[model samples]
Target: MTDLVVPAVINLDVPGPVISRHLYGHFAEHLGRCVYGGLYVGEDSDLPNAGGIRLDVVEALRALDVPNLRWPGGCFADEYHWMDGVGPRDRRPVMVNTHWGGVEESNHFGTHEFMALCELLGAEPYISGNVGSGTVREMSDWVEYLTRDGDSPMVRLRRANGREEPWRVKFWGLGNEAWGCGGHMRAEQYAAEARRFGTYCRDHGGNRLYRVAAGANGDDYAWTETLMKQLGDLGCAHRPAPFMQALSFHHYTVPGSWEDKGDATVFDTDDHYRTMVAAARVDELLTGHSNVMDCYDPGRNVGLVLDEWGTWWNVEPGTNPGFLYQQNTLRDALVAALHFDVFHRHADRLVMANIAQTVNVLQAVILTDPDTGALVLTPTYHVFEMNKGHQDAASLRVDLPAGLPSREVGRASLTTVSLSASRRDGRVLVSLSNLDAAEAVDVELDLRGGAVADVRARVLTAGRLQDHNTPAAPDVVAPRPHEVSATGSGLRVPLPAHSFVTVEGRLA
Candidate 1:
């Protein structure tokens, strides 16, 4: 057998950007049961609920301190007409969600319901407007209805609909996938449309909206360059151009193409390794996109918003194909950890990232059974819970040892280990992920500016790569206490195979 490799050393130091808590955000689309059964069970249902939303899910999300929630659509947003969702629920219009499932939307869970949910979860509401199928007036009026406090036609309608106080909505997307589902518009065309629509998405009362342009999908560098260049030109001429607080980018980690996204829970070690490799590609995407953004806006005034991201696989068998629901397994937990690490490392450029999605949808953190009223937190959820301490913490510079081994599955390859570190509340927290399917890693930590006073760790791992929590066994992959010991000027810790670990220590 090959001799065990020397422990990898990581040197941690102070002085870095604070990881934005918004990076821990979530996405809720009107796809599958995500909005309906997943989040809303109706007020009259037998299941316990707050207003029309399920209380259990609310409490779980509240515990996560979910920073922000992007709503209404993936493709559904551009097709959505804000007017259809307001007013009396009984009188609301019903429309077909042709983009997601072919099911009819009751319109009961409209603007008010969404804002109410955001209020309940203590999360900022990020609304995506309709540019493909909606006019500028409609988008502007919708913003007015939600944020306006003074007398206005939209405010009057809001009051007539029973809401006396306006809701504070700060983040707004100009459109979703304008190059594709949103409308087959060219980058130049979409940029012009965004400018026109953003001109009317005015700040009302105390609410100042951060407008995000419809950005590139994956590594479509040209899309980012074109939009940024055009918008940059407009800014130079107009002084302060409309909207443009951020430019949105959507990337999902699928082993294969969209036509065959592979299975969620049935993958072997090879497939799992490939998935990890794909997830690591987010770093490349962010770097390329950021480089393009730098060329136009070298001052970095604008941020990058990863509005929609996460694993997308073939739907659970027998489920509606269009719903886009899939199981979350140990593999997903690693994928999440990988992305979170990347997001934290680049917190300076990233404003927010909404995992796609929250419940009963693609790589959801939580899953629910409508018939049995059962709820389960996936392995991905545990990763989020353990890493919550990193939110808003100062991201520390970590010097990882070079020459780490790279494991390969066919053409795909990934470093055996991934990590990120932060300092908060007089303590240093380090997150580590071991992507190897076999071989636990021995890691050494070198604390530069401070010494470790006390250390504690939490780890999420399972017996099998495919292990996941079903309703019958919800704690199958939950986090458990991990042991760490001081060694010389650092600490030594063992990271189990295919695991996500977070270690926290009081600094001296």
Candidate 2:
């Protein structure tokens, strides 16, 4: 018997909130190659593309069942002029990407291109309107141009631009980060802007817009408090999205200080441990923000959207620093799993959460070298793929003993084990993360409610803590069949250290 053990009981009968597939959402910014090269390889390029959008990238994101894609900008959204991206590709005006690398923006992947990209991936389009530097008219016109049908000015403009029917764009962001790169506005001030922008950015035709207000930064409870009190409050108890359907928050797990966010490929155990501890902080932030929301909107009608959350490591060596590019590793995969565990636990209030990026920037799932058409799925990609079953599944609480296991890193102690479960389509899905850097832990999982049979499992693990996939060796850290032993009352699942595992079986 191993000294390190996790005894968990998954209650099958008790039902919990259904996990939103949008919780597995993705973000694509105009930063770095994420747009120009990563997702778009140009119409004339030799790489396979549909209307200039990379087909390989679309296929890869499609494999993950990507729920929705937030586009056009991060900081760029505030400075982005939607008009500059429409019309003929060459005739479109260009601007400088001041937020990322000070590179010139061709405005090629604008409103029309993004809609096409989303269609190819079968994902919903979540556009962040320019609220910081852009006017309410611009945001409203863009909304009308995308969703309004028939012969209006915006509709005429849309038809002239080549797309005949209006695209149904529901999820709209009022802004990015109003306190920072977005606009440098206070919570109260931004709330006013959100209300005004959301008002004019109306539901055209039958397309009702789900406007998302730019929300608090990490743990900025006052910001959330202010937004709910000012924007979300309908002068009553929990009005259902009076002005804004959701509020957005951005949090990234930077392993170290912003000056040095730890290296992507090179890091000591202490660095790795700290990253895990920081990754787990999302739960605390979620709880804090949720608690504040409960105070203002008890009915939880105003959903919380974590529009930006992921690891923000130092840019890869020799790469453009402002691009926020970094490699994903086994540790990064573990970070994603920890966030998902928390996301499932708070499924009732949290509607959607998009990783900082989908490709080539920050913690991207798919990295592509556009010049060579080389694309590799990061370790984080595998975690998303393995747990796709949990999307829209009923959350099942994982009850574990108080004293499970722990590892100390400085003042904080990392819980070496974490797990979450959900059920859908008559099957139970379980995800377990063993954070111990050296020893694998055996989990004695007790299955309750009704009997489960034909238990199967797969794991994402690597030899080294920093093991990652590159184009040359893309399969270095991929999921493979994992062994599951049937126990008297449950199952014995061995979770390797610094790894993530998911098990599934039909409920009888």
Candidate 3:
């Protein structure tokens, strides 16, 4: 062992912030096969489906206990027209999806179909409204159509489309990326539009809406500053206006520059180390935005929502460039664990977060093959399953001892080991990751303030960092039982190179 490596300590009795289950939220956009072929395979196909929505995908997401599903667009939300997708499927309008591959879109998976998918998964529906080219009336009418009742004009329109009852939608987004694809609007321009559009999205028939303003892009603090100053700040200290409850921003982990992101399955130890360096920027990004928010709204009344996040690599070869299909690797799993740890610590300010796309897209948990209808769970999926205990649990503080193992890349130096812990229902869960590419490291955990018993551990890793799953070999990078040894005052845990481990036990 190197002299720089040292032990760590965790105070389980001193529980910190409560991690929001909504932090484990997901996003499904209308680009490429994400909607048509990825989530919906039609009722006529041999695959199991209900009302043209695939059951296999629903069943998989249910296992994750998904909190919410954001739908209908990334950039596609700006140009989407809600009325064109309701009523009869055969009678719905067909339009071109100019943003993604310029492909023609059949308005088959509309509002009702999306609400049905949410029902099947037991997840909340977070619908992002059209703002770039849509009007105030269109946004207001869509809200009424989904939530209003008592024979209102929009309710009657919804009834003619065959839904007798209204759905209770809690989360609603005003727009997406107004600085770019949503529109070329300045920060001030988007804020004024958000204020006007949010005024008319009324709550009706007991359905309350949580209006989230589309916030900054990446590390654009000026954008965040503009929104905080202009919208909903009626000035009486901590209270923001009712129309705007939360604000959202986006960040993605790209291994290389945007012009040329490296391939998913082709990489080396150096690449793996460099990727961890890129992933560590998430902590700085969240802190930068949260600091700016604190200066304006000191009471933390307005919640920060990271609605779009995850890794983005180049599309697989021979695939459409806009489809965003990439293979998931062991490195991807570590990136997910690293991000969640930062999110757990920032729970006080950050209320919700959603990974980019759930199926057949960038950093997807489930990928459906084009040739065969077989579904493969990626390494990223196993990370979600292992860390599910952290959802809504009270986050525990984990800290490295002095002189802990550290590795330097560029101007950044990161600890070789990353750890996050939480307590819920008389049990404590600890998730640890080793970022060293070629060597195993031992972690000594000094457990304090609680009597623990029956500790169990599981690990997810592969022979190579780039190893991923396919239909032919599904269990290559899956989780299996790991070993944990007892120490005089605590426990000694050993983790392999490029691996993720989880330890769980009940409090006595």
- Top TM-score model: 2
Could you tell which candidate, 1 or 2, scores higher by lDDT? Answer: 2
Worst 10 residues of 1 by lDDT: 1-10
* Model 2 residue 249 distance off true place after TM-score fit, in angstroms: 0.8
lDDT of 3 by residue, 1-508 (tens): 3233347888979999899999999999998678878889877878899998989989988999999999887899999999999988899999988899898889899999999999999999999999998999999999999998789899999999999999999899999989989998999999999999889999987898899999998899999989888644533465677778889999998879898888799988778877888887888989999998887788888889999988899999999998888899999999999989889989999999999889998989999987899899999999998999999999999877564577887677876788889999999998889888887887877889986689999999999999999999988999999998877766777888889999898987
Query: Which model, 2 or 3, shows the larger lDDT?
Result: 2
lDDT of 1 by residue, 1-508 (tens): 1234335444455569889999999999999999999899899988898879989999999889899999897899988998998887899999999888688999889999999899999999999999999999999999999989979999999999999898889999999999999998999899899889988899987889999999998999999988787656533233225567789899999998879999988988888888888999999999999988877776677889998999999999999999988999999999999999999988888989999999999989999986798999999999899999899999987776554557777776788788888888888888998899988886777677668677899899999989999989999999999988777868777788888999998877
Winner on lDDT between 1 and 3 is: 3
The best candidate in terms of lDDT? 2
Among residues 3 or more apart in sequence or in different chains, the pairs in candidate 1 whose N, CA or C atoms overlap within 3 Å are: none
- CA lDDT of each prediction against the hidden true structure: 0.88, 0.90, 0.89
Tens digits of per-residue lDDT for model 2, 11-92: 8988799999999999999998898889988899888999889898899899999999998868999999999999999899
**Sort by lDDT, top down from the best:** 2, 3, 1
**Model 2 TM:** 0.98
Question: TM-score rank, highest first?
Answer: 2, 3, 1
TM-scores of the candidates are 0.96, 0.98, 0.97
Clashing pairs in 2: none
